[model samples]
Target: MSSSEVECGPSFPELIRRKRDGGQLSKQEIGAFMRGITSGSIQEGQIGAMLMAIWQKGMVAEETVALTQEMMHSGEVLQWPKAWDGLVVDKHSTGGVGDKISLSLAPALAACGVKVPMISGRGLAHTGGTLDKLESIPGFTVTQPVEKIRQILEDVGCCIVGQTETLVPADRVMYALRDATSTVDSLPLITGSILSKKGAEGLNALVLDVKFGKAALYKDLDSARGLAQSMVTVGNGMGIRTGAVLSRMDAPIGRMVGNTLEVCEALECLKGQGPDDLEELVKSLGGYLLWMSGRTASLEQGQEALAKVLHNGAALQKFEAMLQAQGVSADIARSLCSSQCDYFLHLKPAEHKTELTAQSDGTVVDIDGMVLAQVLHALGAGRTKAGEPINHSVGAELLVILGQKVKKGEPWLRIHYDSPAPNAKQHSDLQAALLVGKADSYLASPRVAEFILPPKM
Candidate 1:
């Protein structure tokens, strides 16, 4: 069928056929599909078939833009007229293993005088989610209403909340269906889902950290670049200035991965004492957002401004203040530890410690991010369903990083787990996943791979 013939609320077979045959969908057809899926008028199987077809046939730039706009309009938009003096800026990472840049960057930017209303997601598959990690703190709720979210951003200049059901409800339904149907990786669908929520934020500018490696959703450079380009195209079409950084993911961003552990690492970064690779990424992303917001003329100047906040302890102070305002206390702060996750409930804190003694260690060559995340998942460190609670206290600690020297029979990395959950399978998975090599081995890994810029057109 031609675009004009495809009516709103069309038959499942007709809609499926149009997309499956590489025909364009009218805006009304796309809008109706979103509303139908979200309003329960559409069955899961039909939605799955249509999504599969869209994934196979692909969406053009115009279709992608229309899809994003419809999704954005299905929900409420947030803004702060009086509080934010300059352009309100936000950052998103295409989920990555051990990526906790938001925990630092949000407060760091806010401290630098920009409003950051960050709506984050939870872990799905192998990558960590920002909302899941932030919730590790006691009483640190992510379910605040839109009014409170506005107040929080006004009072503290930043607030991280769970993506409200009312905001981009369409994307929520589509994503759930995509997840079940194995169509979650479609570039246009991914782009629409991401930009819709981000666009609904009423943001002046946005930055994305498009990651590529074994652990990220986009597992290679080509896929990551394609995803980045689609997002930029859609964001620009909607009048939101957008850019992306194609960062390395050969190894995890920081030393930790589980909720609380990663939070502590982010805290360290805000205090100007974080891993080198993680720090570089923070400065790079923070700098880009600053430039987009017109706070800095160049990346170097933005980096220096970010450094002042980190080194002067302003960022850490803002973070603590925000946490306190959000209801987390200092006494219970240690629960942020990767081993203390069991404190929340029937979940037990990780008590078992297994030292991975080096068999013939010269240097640590690689740490597989996906394998590491799977080990945590198997060990009950994270939840499979959105409703499942995480054991935030249980996680791994690396004693030897990549390019670090190690002695034979010495500890390379320590595996910490809450012993209550059965972990026989996870232990084997973790063992096979972490690989170490001889110091004499020649290939040296750079901290960053390449930079992905915004689309010029």
Candidate 2:
């Protein structure tokens, strides 16, 4: 069937055929499609086939917008209290190694007097997920119902939870099919999947961390920018303030990479004492969000506001409160945020640990995050497919900074693992991730490459 012949209540095969032949689906057809997904009127195999068709033929901007709106309304659309008017905001990242910014950013934004109902996901490919990192904390839960999410946000100003069965039900089915069908990279599909969940949140503003590099979804700045612009457009068109940051992801965002270790690093950042790169990312993403939400006079002022809370113990207090609100014991949350808490004693640690030393001495210039992530993923730190179990303790700690000079045989990386330590080949790959160069040749750069802002609305 051609585009014009595909009616609102068209047959499933014809709907698929129209999209497969590059015909743009009408809004009513998209809405009908979403209804089928949520009501189980559509089979999984048919959904997978349709996803492949959409991946190959692609959807126009209007079709993407319609799809997102339908998916968002497929289930419950959260209705926050009217007092939250322009205060609801959230940020999302397109997965990256050692990317734990969400762990601290949410609470920090909350400290600035905004509502953050953060609905996050699990690890995808080589990058870690926000919910997975939060799960590493003892007693921390990510499956809050909408009412409970609202309660948590009301009390603590923030809550990071995953999708409940009734929230964004359309994306839940379609998202699973995308991975199985190898259509995970489709631009319109990704936009709909991401925005549908955020749209369900009833957010006032959103910021996207579109990363590009060896370990990111997009391998170059231009491609990342394109994705950033697409999301920005759709988000703004939906009446939400939206923007994006194009960040480089060649190296890990923070010094640690693993489930529990990332939680520890995030706590350190919450306490105002972690890697500078992590701090920069939080400020950039959070600042723009604050500005777009109308909480600050300007972006710079917003950044300063976020940094002030981050450094003045305000954000830490909010994080502690949020933890307790989300099922963590008050004592454990307090100790974890205390100045002298030993993380391994409070949180779980790996069964075995080993350190890799530098083979030659020079200024550290680069660390290939992809190589490190792959090795850790093999060590059971991450999953190869959805539903696979991962070892929370499997992770790595970078001992040296990118621009720091090192001596030969210096311990540069500490690997935390279980059962079997890294085999000979894994050890070599981890060591090869480091690159040393002349001291003067190494130049530190910003993790944020550029910002993609929506047109004035």
Candidate 3:
């Protein structure tokens, strides 16, 4: 057997039994559990049972630590050059609607002299995926061999790609089992799944954007905070400097939602002309990451440094370079990044377009993000099951921002879709997403509500 494959250990039922009844597991026991799956000694049914057990009876700090470490070690742990230490960094998001922060943040960080080997995944259920967004660019490649990935990092300073086959193999088997078992939201399992892949990347520091709101995985602050704390502790325990940003996901992040539309918005963000909320998130997340890696004196200073790159054209240049490094043609990359170029000319746009208008006059209060995600998912922008193909051109664009006053018959949202367009009910749902409230109670909420840092070791 290869050294990366985990070795089989003690009784599987014994570990399941101990965890089922709320008993703590030793590091050796958890290691065995992770290895058994990686070694093919564990069955899927038992894996499901243990997932439920972890869901029902939560893990203690030590057990969580063991599970994260074991999962990370179940496959090949990536190696970097000696000089890259403390300069390699990454950011992960517990996803939400229209969350395309990574698209702008990774390349921007690279421009700041950080090495970003970003491993991303596809969209499942309602939340959009970074890989899916990047795929909208005709020739952008999301997978690269280790040698090429290293070269890209050395040249471009950043590369967003998928987890290699040998990287975090244990999480591959068990992570798939999570959704089917209804234990998808379990805290320990989430930490293990997220941090394991990141740990395999040999990162020196990590930042998490753990979202919470109507459209977020955790619907409230307390639930999201618990998951964030669990991830922070587990991540730090695994020897990676880690922290989290608690951001609200009540509405779609930018002026757009879906694969291609988000890519366009992200490009605009790269040019320092995107929506206020989207730009804020990129700066806030990237700023915290820079501070976590000790590149800046404070979080605010880190933000200013990042913002400087965005407006000065350095970050956008890195993004154009990243596109070509990842397989996009040089001409296409340059044109798309150019200020005078139109994005839709080079990228695919939907076959049909429909606009929705405001029916009454009032200040806009809420635009339901969950509603938009579901509608867009139905329109072929998302996948119900893994490996299902999505329509990159299918998406929606907001014509008005939150708190804007609109008169009757004013166009509020424009949807792009293919033939067999949205039915009456779907159209109604889209209209329902926009909510207007009296102007008296207009209070603009912060996109980033709180920043949670790791405790000093």
Report the number of the highest-lDDT candidate. 3
Q: lDDT of candidate 1 vs native?
A: 0.78
* Clashing residue pairs for model 2: none
Ranking by TM-score: 3, 2, 1
| Ten residues in sequence with the least summed lDDT for candidate 1 | 334-343
Cα lDDT, model 1, residue 438:
66
Error of 3 at 81 (Å): 0.7
- Which segments of model 2 are wrong by more than 4 Å? 1-9, 43-45
For model 3, how big is the CA root-mean-square deviation? 2.3
User: Per-residue alpha-carbon lDDT of model 2 for 409-439, expressed as tens digits?
Assistant: 9999999999667999999998889999898
lDDT (C-alpha) at residue 420 in model 3: 63
> How many clashing pairs does model 1 include?
4
Q: Rank the candidates by lDDT, best first.
A: 3, 2, 1
lDDT of 1 by residue, 1-457 (tens): 3222334356756888989999999888888777676666667777889899989999999999999999898878876675464568899988777889999999899888888889888887677778877777667888888888888887888888888868988887788889899998798888988899998998988888888888777678898888888888788888887888887786677787787678778877877877888888888888888877788988789878888898787887778767866777754543432233343442224577677777675677787878888877777777777778777777777776788877788876676677555366766666666666766773765545665555551
C-alpha RMSD of each candidate structure in angstroms: 4.1, 2.3, 2.3
Candidate 3 structure quality by residue, lDDT tens digits, 374-444? 99899899998889999999999999888999888999999999966999999899889999878875789
